[model samples]
Target: MSVIWKGVFPAVTTKFNDNDEMDFAAFDKNIEAQLEAGAKGIIIGGSLGEASVLSDTEKIELLKQTVKTVNKRAYVILNIAEQTTKAALLCAENALKYGADGLMMLPPLRYLADKHETLEYFAAVAKSTPLPIMIYNNPYDYKIEVTLDMFEELSKYENIQAVKESTRDVSNVTRMINKFGDRFKLMTGVDTLALESIFMGAHGWVAGLVDAFPRETVAIFNLAKQGRHEEALKIYRWFLPVLELDIHPKLVQYIKLAETQTGLGTENVRAPRLPLVGEERTRILAIIDNAIANRPELPAGSWGVEA
Candidate 1:
């Protein structure tokens, strides 16, 4: 069967109530909104969803809730990135049981792991699940680099089917496409570089900011797929700055704040992560507000449409 994960799949946000508890209702609403707004599928419990702070019970409950809410309208992917293969395997098994379309995993991050350790971790997790798996290789955030050769080597696993290449290095993507071709699905984890990736032969994009602007992100992929690069690049340039914040160390905070300002989602993130404030917060808010205010009056999927 073909992979169910192609196109604009947003790394969804996990909503919390005023009491700082998981708001099942709000989370439910957000899922429906994204699907209705034309998202191809939705990703849960990733960096955008604050997967690190959530407990195992929380992850399971959220996955169950997501299944119940989305039903079968859109693809549901569980992001189960952990430092240990044990955790990743358990999470993948549970996710598969709950009807997740696929699994996305990040590399071991607590300690610096060698190429051998990393490959073994993925192989173990791949064997643990029946579902297809996507390796989330974001070297920028983890400071752990996965060389093209290492990635090429790991793609041999039966279930290790896709790579979320977030390094934004064009050459890296080019090499992967040249070496692997259709053997492994290559998706861009960085939104700003998404168009370039498509032109270079990426299968899809795993976007964090899609929660706020589904139409824009979806347009980039759809347009480029149709060979409408001139049109796609325009929206790419417009959405670039706002999308850059998603890669920042303070990504969750800025995203939460932007959601609040847009009436899209809440700004209430769990502690150890605080709300944006002072000049930095102000600058960020202004950046988002200005984008929205100055945003062109384009129709849905207009990013792909010519002016």
Candidate 2:
């Protein structure tokens, strides 16, 4: 239970060339944009970063580059979820070697579970690194869920500092906070539920939308932290459309498109994960454009989408 592992950690998308190799320059630029925009940390090689598609060497290089570029301004978290414990250990060791601030891991996929196996999966990964660990509890993405009872047990780990709680159920969040309030730091991963989670006493947001709208993310969290409910609601209303887009599996495509359209990061991504096209592309672009046009008071690129 370390307290250092809390706040708005955006899972940064890894940039790539058309040939599908790691594009270090673009990746660094993306990290810089996020740090400058007020992200508490950069989550390199998470789902948003297409970690599954990345080669082992690419993941190592990306972590190395992230450490070099971030220069310690924010906490650095690396996502190391694989189908095997040995694979997770190897990746976790690599991240720790590069001086990462923490590690986030999901349960081993493809296993039909018993509670015993689930506990083993996490304990094995936690044993791999001394760095603070954030259990990435996204049942929708990983299909392996960690129950609250599981949380009570896992919180006993000296290194298991926080839970990246992506379950959109506010009641579940409330229960976790009420039960494990003093034990684990609960960070919301669902952007649409972020303000609510904070107000409910959850620690912070591990946000995807923060890459596109860091200022708004900061404003929402800051106002809520100060008990300014009405002001926070105002910012949340303006940012809701963009925030709601993150509810989809195609979040990477929409956020990247918004980035390119507004000059935050390149829209290019690795293979096996193609860019948005046709109706998807058109709809995302239009919404971003309309939002920017309506908020002329917010500068060009202030919102990280085209005006």
Candidate 3:
């Protein structure tokens, strides 16, 4: 079955309580806000969602809850960021068993597998489950670049359907289109580069900041798709500072704090990843507050029209 992988899909954060347990109340509230704000899909257990820290039980429960909360209104994608092929396959199988509509998988976690190893690994997981896969090609963060040559090899798989292109090089968007055409549905993975990627013909955005400012994020994509570049840029210029938080080392904490300020969720994160403190916390809050204080009034119309 072909999944139409288009529109803004937020790499949502996993909410936790002060006691370090998954906070279902906050989690469900965030999901409802994203769906209500017209996000095309919700991605759970991603790097933004703190996948590395979450246990298998927690990951599975999150997937099940997201699938239940979305209830066919939007796609629920489970991010598989495991180290071994075996573990990756197991997660894929479990995601399917728990009702994930699709998956967004990174290359071999932490090992930085080479071209041949990466291709084989993705091919294995793609074959393990029938769910459509979005290959996350974020060389900047993951240190593994899924080159055009590797994509060519993986393209033979029927289920490897989309890519979250986050090389941080906007030109790579054109390069992928120039080479593969539509074999892989290209979704811009970086929050800051979203408008440029859309302008360059990317099919969608797997966004980060949308967790806090869903309407503006959706508005930028829809306006650009509608050829309203001026309107989109107006929002984009105002949105740039907050979007930068998505690329930071402390993105989970930063974004969660933004969520709290916006009344969407809490700033509570798991241990080893404490909440932002001191001046850093104050600075992030100021950025979010300034934007909120001067938040642009979105043009009146329906948003999130699929590209």
Candidate 4:
């Protein structure tokens, strides 16, 4: 069964209650909103979702809940960010057991594995599971660049289907296409570069800000895909500032605040990751308020295409 990996797949934040436990009520509500807004899929336990702080059990339960709530309406991809090969394989097995539709995996965390080590780790995990995988290539955050040559070697694995292109270099989009052609599907992982990536033939987006502004995010992708560049630009220009929030260190706090302001979710993040406060909070709120007050009218009728 080929999973159609395309369009906006929000790297959704894991909602927690005041006691630092998973808040299913808020979580389910958020998932419903994403589906209603025409999100192609929902990704849980990603960097945006705070995967590092979550325990293994919490990660599995989150994947299970997402799979049940989404109920085949869209893809539910679990992020595999582990320290060792054994742990990564365990996460992959658990994801398959809990009915995850696919996975988005980062290379060895914190160790900065070299190219050969990275390739070996990925190949081992790919062989261990039958689920489709999207190799995340974000050197800016991970410090490990899965170079084009590394991809050439890993392309032999049939389950390694796509890449989350977060290199921050827009030109890499073209470079990947030039080298691999249609061998690997490219999905823009950076929220700010989404429109440019789509215009450059990227098939999808692993979005961050869409957790709060789903309709606008989907609109930009659809409009550009339909060749409506002027209309897409109008929305993209308005969205750039809000999208910048996703790339920051406090993205979890900032995006959750946006969700609360928009009436979609809450601002209760886990400990050590407190809610945005002080002047920083005021500054972000100002941006969200300005965008909301002057929100652009979306094009009439459905703006999304089926994957």
Candidate 5:
């Protein structure tokens, strides 16, 4: 439970092969790149990971793989987006057994839980595990906002230490800070708004585009944290177009394609999510490739491994 719950934690995409099987080798490469770029943790089986199609066993296996791949270099957090509190508890419990350091938990999906129900569900899972939890409050997408009042109640659980804040409204960052102060560490979840969120007092980023451009993502946060706003903004501007990909419905496909272009991963996503094709594919590639061509140079100092 000693996780920092800050910095660039990638909501990683689950790497698959053309056969649609889990491709650990491809997965490992991207992970190595993440670590090298100084990600704070690895959030597996998130929306970006194609979590819905992955079975429970597969999720567990993914956790095991991440724990091994990370090798104590960073935190390995499993995303729990289940339909029932019972199932989420089971997932969180299993995550602890497999060496996960923390969890990025959403409200019970499929049901669109109301406030009381959402609070109860989160409480059940929070009390179920000793591992620290970062409750994901993304109302726009998930249809459940873990409001300040809800957090006031959940704050009783010591392990519920952080939040993946994706409310889309930057002002909410200040509101949370105004009420809760330091009770919950905040990590921004949206890629497009990440730099602004961080400047507004978000402690870290549960980043999406980091799957492909880990260095730039990490550098933005690292530099901004150091009060190098001018430098951070420079990279963020060049990064804007590519960062928008994370907000798309086909984000998994879009990011995987970016990974392939970067030599960090492949474009193979799980089924029901076919690889991006035709005009859409061409359009997305234009954005990614264009970013690649005009990528900015980070400050030549020790930001991380290569700095």
Candidate 6:
């Protein structure tokens, strides 16, 4: 089935063992938690998944393994952060062969292409693949903004179905809605801003913390979408401190640690990106521990459970 472009889509972390090999068992466990918690889709090999460090062959293997694990229970979307258009197209094409349900793609990796170049890059990729695509519009990390005007140009592509709205400007959600009005499904990419964006009009969340706190993450989206803001806010308030971790430079390590605490995975990261240590590690531990100790009791409803 094609992606509906709605609900929680966890940008899952890539699991690596002590020998620096892909741990498919651990990876499938995390994906299972997300699906059990009602995740609509799974985004593999994203920034949170250490996309920068993963080889293309590794990414394809991850997608293939995830497809085997999911068995069509939820959409399996591969993230493409390639530095060049050709590489991006190749990634998308490989995703197609592995039965990938969709894609969450970033702008050109290291290059800050101008509007025309950026638009053309997206068009070229979108034109190459038949899969539905969600433009990962995160300016803070990538340095290139996918402006509304550029989106206006991108809107012509039938396959460009959504935007991972990470601009952090809540008003941009409103502006996108006013300008395009459901032409694109808007899923907030920032963890802390999720409820705010949802209230404003984002269709779903491309969540980071969900990799660790799958049930809590899905509960917030479900409660809020049902117009249960007060209920969602209670959990969101308790969740704020840990959700803030997603915005940090060492987010992959931080979230992996959270996953470790939850028994979902480990903190093993690729080379050049070692595990956290010192006061920073202690400080992050305190935050994670506090959230775990004082974890909010989820209110009862459609998505309400501590599972």
Cα deviation of 78 in candidate 5 (Å)? 0.7
Candidate 3 similarity to native, TM-score: 0.98
Cand. 2 Cα-lDDT: 0.77
Task: List TM-score per model, in order.
Answer: 0.93, 0.92, 0.98, 0.98, 0.98, 0.97
Separate clash counts for every candidate = 0, 0, 0, 0, 0, 0
Error of 5 at 43 (Å): 0.6
Give the number of the best model, judged by lDDT.
Answer: 6
Per-residue lDDT for 123 in model 5? 89
| lDDT of prediction 1 | 0.80
Task: Please give the distance, in angstroms, between residue 52's alpha carbon in candidate 3 and its true position after superposition.
Answer: 0.4
Better of 4 and 6 by lDDT: 6
Q: Which portions of model 3 show Cα errors greater than 4 Å?
A: 302-307
lDDT scores in order: 0.80, 0.77, 0.90, 0.90, 0.90, 0.91
| Model 2 CA deviation exceeding 4 Å by range | 1-3, 296-307
Residue-pair clashes, model 3? 0
Runs in model 4 lying further than 4 Å from the true structure: 302-307
Estimate candidate 6's alpha-carbon lDDT, on a 0 to 1 scale.
Answer: 0.91
Minimum summed lDDT over a 10-residue window in model 5 is located at: 298-307
Error of 5 at 150 (Å): 0.8
Q: Could you give candidate 3's per-residue lDDT for residues 1-307 as a string of tens digits?
A: 4578888899999998888899989989988888877888899999989999999999989998888889999988999999999999999999889999899999999797888899999999998889999999988988999998888898899899999999999999899999988889999999989999999999999999999998889888888888888989999999999999988999999999999999988989888889888999999999999999989988755364453
RMSD of 6: 1.7
Model 1 weakest 10-residue run by lDDT? 298-307
lDDT of 5 by residue, 253-307 (tens): 9999999898989988777788888999999999999999998888865246422
For candidate 1, write residues 26-46 as lDDT tens digits: 677667767765566678999
lDDT of 3 at 280: 94
What 10-residue stretch in candidate 4 is worst by lDDT?
298-307
